[model samples]
Target: MKKVIEKKVYNTETATLIAEYWNGLGEDDFMYCEEYLYRTRKGSYFLRGSGGPLTKYSESNENQTWGISTIIPISKEEAYEWLEANDKTEAIEEYFSNDIDEA
Candidate 1:
């Protein structure tokens, strides 16, 4: 599990991250990529993902960078489908469980 450090970049600054999947283990620094689920303050859902050479410059003589990224608006149902397909089990149980949290 190589550590993933997420930042509030130009695109996701207005939303709250709900869950993420980072495929970084054993990947070269310049080849890591990931996906994330997010929700807006108003309850809208979206997905943001990045792939390819996200860290192309980290080992080079230049500033670092994240890979190409994309944001897609999705329905709540779609969000759940995506999460399940990606095996985000913890996130599903935590965020969409029928049993309510007492907190």
Candidate 2:
């Protein structure tokens, strides 16, 4: 199934932070797409919101980074709808919540 990703991200710096964090750790388990940033762990994964076409970077002499030309063109409402339809928020919450038995 086509992954439904959120439109609203926590901050504009999130993408950069993620890229930098991954770079710092020297990992290559993430893929940047027009919809969302996909990170895989043990063959499973999750998506996070980020600038789509506008979230790329050019080749730089200082550090190697992704070149996000644009972000996923969407709004907050659309993002929420996608989340609800995919039931991702619930799954994520259930996974992270302290009250695992309650859920």
Candidate 3:
């Protein structure tokens, strides 16, 4: 079984991680995806998604064939939906809470 990873990560592309749903550390799949939820200092919520394929299908396939990508400002509704689909209760509460945070 793949080991579960629980650690903090800093991605300057988006905001820092407030609640890490999937770290994708010990995954051995061909395509691995990681989801991290963050809240800016102004209380704005954002989900930082980052991932890529583990191996290339061809030797000359370095032209970005796969659709692996990371979107910076994922919609609040979409973020909530993702959280709910993943069953992140604690993150769900913190996501809609009145507390402030820093990215």
Which number leads on TM-score? 1
Assess candidate 3 and give its TM-score to the true structure.
0.52
Runs of candidate 3 exceeding 4 Å displacement:
1-16, 23-28, 54-71, 97-103
Q: Give the residue spans of candidate 1 off by over 4 A.
A: 1-11, 25-32, 53-67, 98-103
Candidate 3, residues 36-76, lDDT tens digits: the string is 67654554555555454653221226574442434355556
Worst 10 residues of 3 by lDDT: 1-10
All candidates' lDDT scores?
Answer: 0.67, 0.35, 0.53
Task: Tell me the tens digit of each residue's lDDT in model 1 across 1-103.
Answer: 1122343232467677888878764345566767789877777677776666544212323665445666767788888887889888787887678633546
Worst 10 residues of 2 by lDDT: 17-26
Which candidate tops lDDT? 1
TM-score of 1: 0.58
Error of 3 at 58 (Å): 15
| Per-prediction backbone clash count | 1, 15, 0
lDDT of 1 at 44: 69
TM-score of 2: 0.24
